[model samples]
Target: MKKLTSIIAIATSMATAEVANAQSQYYKKAEQNPYTLVYDGAITKNEKGKVNIHPVKYKLNGIEIAANVYTPANYDASKNYPAVAVAHPNGGIKEQTAGLYAQRLAEAGYITIAADAAYQGASGGEPRHTDKPQFRTEDIRGMADYITQYPGVDAKRLGVLGICGGGGYTLKAAQGDKRFKAVATLSMFNSGEVRRNGFQNSQLNTVQDRLKQASDARAQEAAGGEVKFSGVANITDEEIAKTSTDLYREGYEYYYRTHAHPNSTFLYTTSSLLDLMTWDAAEHMDLIEQPLLMMAGSKSDTKYMTDEAFPKAIHAKNKELFLIDGATHIQTYWKPEYVVQAVNKLVSFYKTNL
Candidate 1:
C-alpha cells in the first residue's frame, strides 16, 4: 500500500508541474498581423487579383460571432461558388489551422469561412472559454446560416470541414442540418469520449470523480461564486517533451510554440463538463446521410477516435477514411507536406461531392 501511494503521489506531482509553466513559448502579438492570423503563409494583405480575406461579424443567439471569409482569387460575386465552413479545433481560434484550411480551400476556387466559436476567441459570451458541445455544434450551424446567404454562395453546394474537437461538433451539426451537402473532418477527435473516458481511456476508473468536480463547478457558478476552469494554460519545453502522446506533445508545440496565436488557448470552464460528459460525437452516426470524407494522420495517437467513429456512419453516402501516411495529429495541422496532401484530398472530395 505504501509503495502504491508513493507512485500516485509522484504521478500527481508530474501532472501539476505540467500545467504550471509560464506563458506560451511562442505567443504572437495580435498586432503583428493585420488579420491576427498566426499560421505560416497567412494572408497579410487583401489584393484584388489574389485570394482575399474579409473579416466578418454576425449574431448567433444575440451574441456577436467573429469570422474570416476567404474568397478565391479573381472571385466574382455575380457567379455562383461552392462554399465550405471550416470548424476550428478545441481551444483554437479561427486564425490557426481552420484558417489555413479555409485559405487553401479558397485557393481551390471554393469560398470558405472560419469562425471563432461562441464564448471563445473573439466571439461574444459571458464567462469566456465556456466550451460546451452544444455551443460548438451551434457555431457550425451558424456558419452555415451566414455563409449560405453570402453573395454567390450556392446553398445546395455547401460543405463543412472540421478539425479535432470541431470535427466532432461538425458531425453533430451535419446530422440535423441538411444545408451541408458534403461533410469532411481532418484529424477527427471525439471530444466527449475523451473527456468522459480520458485520452486512451486512461482515466476510466475516475469517471465519477471528475463528474463530481464538474457538478461542483456548476453549483459554484449557480451561486455566483468563482468560475472554476480546467486544462493547461501553459506548458514548459521539458513537459512538452515528456508528454507521452504525439497528440498532446505536438499539440502544445503547435498551439503554444510553433504556430501560437494570441486568442488560442487550452482552457475551458469546468462547468462545461456537465454537458460534455454525457455527449458522444458518434451517437447518431447513421443520421449523417451526406457524403462523408474523414481524414486522419496515420501515426496520430488520436487516430483511434476517427477509426471508431467512421465505421459507425452506416448510412452515410460514399463515406471514406483516408489516412495521411507518417503524419501525426498535430502534423496534419501545420506540416507543409501533410497539409498539401490533406488539402488535395479535400479538393478532390469537395469537387466530387459538392
Candidate 2:
C-alpha cells in the first residue's frame, strides 16, 4: 500500500508539472501576441492623428460588450463620416479578422467597429459561451445603435460587414434592421443550417440524438447542477492534419495553430445547441431591401451555405454574390493577397452603395 501511494504521488506531481508548463508556454506566447490580435494589419494601441484603434465598452441587452472602433486617418469629430460595423466569426473576437477588416476600412476613410459577442471574448455575460441565434442577431443591431451615436458618424450612411457566423446573423438582422444602409458578408457561415442539419448533412441520422443531449444539458443547468460545456475543447496536431474537410482542417489550423488567439475558443455551453439547432440563416431573407454583397471562397466546403442563402435575398435592392478564386473559407481571413482582394471589393461596394 505504501509503494502504491508513492507511485500515485509521483504520477500526480508529473501531471501537475506538465499542466504548469503548458500554462507557462501559453502566457509566454501571449506576451508576444498580447491582446490576441493575430491579423496582419492589427494595431497594438491607438495612435494619435492617424488611423487609430479605439477599444470600446458598451451595454447591449444589459450585457457589457467589448469592442474596438477604428477611426479614419486625421479624424475630425466636427465633420460627418460614414461608418461600418464588422462582426466577427464563430469563436472569434474583435481582435482577429473583424479588427483586421475594421482597420482596413478605417484606412479607406470609413469609421468601423468590431465587437466581441456578449457571452464570448472579453465581453461580459453569464454562463460563458452561451451562443444563441437571437443574441447573435441582437449584437449586430447593438453595434448600429452605438456607432450611430459616435461623434462624427453619419447614421444615414452606415453599413455593416459580417464575417462567417457573423455573416449569417447579419442576414437575419438586416432582414428587419433598415438602419444598415448596405450589407456585406465575407466567407459567410450559416450557424443555424449547419447546426440543425449538420455539415453537409453528414450527421442527419443522429439529429434527434444530439438534440436530446442538448435538452438534457439545458435541464441540468436549470437545476443548478454541474455546468456542461461542448464544442472542441482540445485537439491533437495529428487529428488536425488528418481532418477531411478544408473548411474545418484549415479552420483548426487558423483558430488553434498559426493564428491562434487566447481569447478565441472552440467551446460553448451544450445548452446553446437547443437554440442553435432550430434557427435558419435564410428564414426571412425577403426583408433585406438594402444593397447587399455576399462573398465566399469558391472551393470552400461551406460555400453551399452562402449559395443557398444568397439567392433567397431576391428582395434586396441590389445584391451580388462573388466567390474568391483559389481560396478556402479560413484563407480569406488571414491570407495577405486574399484579404487585399476582399478589402478592394468591399471598398468598391461601400463607395457605390453607402
Candidate 3:
C-alpha cells in the first residue's frame, strides 16, 4: 500500500508539471490585454514542396513573441541544416512580407523562422505597438539563440535577414552578435533618423521645432492621453503625390489596403519620436566583420539607408549591394520578381558563407 501511494504521488506531480509547462510555454496576458493571435498556416512536409507550418514561441526581454517555423521539404530530424532568422518591419507581422521570405528560403533548403516583434502581432509586450530599438535588436538575438537549439539546426551555420525597420535591427544585431555568420537587410529604415527629421529630413530640422513637438507630446501624455504619431497610416493619395517621396504610394497599397491584416495596429505614441532620433544602426556598422548583403530599390525614397550604411561598413570584406531598378520599397515586399531576386540573393549568400 505504501509503495503504491508513493508511485501515484510521483505520477500526479509529473502530470502537474507538464500542465504548468504547457501554460507557461505560451504567452500570457500582460496587463489588460487577454487575447492572442495564432498563425494556423501549413508548413512543407514532403519532397513535392508540401508545407508543415509549426508554431515557434520564444521569450525576449521577458516578452514571449510568437513565430512561425518553416521546415524545408524532406526535412529530417536526423540531418542537420543551416537556418535563417527573419525579422519583419515595424507595424508588420510574420504573415506579411516576412512570411513570404521565410517560405522561399525554407523551400531553398534552409530552416527559416519569421517572428512577430515585441509589442506587435502575437508577441507579448505591454502598451502594444511601442517600437523600441534596443528591444527589437534583442529580439533578433533571442531568435538566433532559439534556432541554434532546434533538433536539426547547425548553430554555427546561421544567418539573419531583416526587412524595413527589421532590417535596421538586423544590422544592429550583427554588430553585437557574432553567432550570425552573415546578415542582410532590405529597404532598411533608420527609424531614429526618420522619426526625428521626417522623410528625407523634411521636418524637425530645427532644434526649436524638435523641442516644441517634444514638449507638446509630453503635455498630451501627462493629460491622461496618448500622443498622436504619424506615418504611412496618416497619409492619403493626395499627400503621397504631394510629398513625392519615392515609394510612398507602394507603402500605402501594402499597409493600408491589400496586405493589411485586421489585427495589425498602426497607431504609435508621438513620444517615441524622441527615442527614434537617437537610434542609428550605422553607428557601429564598421564593427560587423561578417558578410553583409544590403538590398534596396534604386528609386526607393528609403534608398539612403542602403547608400549610407553600405559605404560605412569597413569591416565587411564580402559585401554586395543590389538595387532593383524598377522596384520600390514596398514593391519588394510581395512583388513576385523582386521577392525572387531578394530570396535568391539571400540563399546564395548564406549557402556560400554559412
Among all candidates shown, the one with the greatest lDDT = 1
Tens digits of per-residue lDDT, candidate 2, 301-337, equal 7889899998898889779998889889999998988
Model 3 regions more than 4 Å off:
1-49, 204-208, 215-229, 232-243
Better of 2 and 3 by lDDT: 2
lDDT per residue as tens, model 1, 1-354: 111111111122233443433333345444578998877898999998899999999999999999999999999999999999999999899989999999999999999999999999999998999999999999999999999999999999999999999999999999999999999999988989988888887768777877888898899999999997788666667767877778888888787777777688788888998898899998999899999999999899999999999999999998999999999999999899999999999999999999
Score residue 202 of candidate 2 by CA lDDT: 68
Q: TM-scores across all candidates? A: 0.93, 0.92, 0.81
Candidate RMSDs in Å, in order, are: 3.5, 6.5, 15.1
Per-prediction count of colliding residue pairs?
0, 0, 9
The TM-score between candidate 1 and the true structure equals 0.93
Candidate lDDT values, in order: 0.88, 0.84, 0.73
Better of 1 and 2 by TM-score: 1
Per residue, candidate 3 scores C-alpha lDDT tens digits across 1-354 of 112111001122122443334333332311112123222222323334454457778877678979978788778878999999999987788877887788788879888888888877888986666677887898899889788888799999999999998999899999989999989999998877666566676655453465466567768877978755534333333433454445555655465444555445455555655666667877888988999999998768789978888988998959999887688898888878878788888888888899
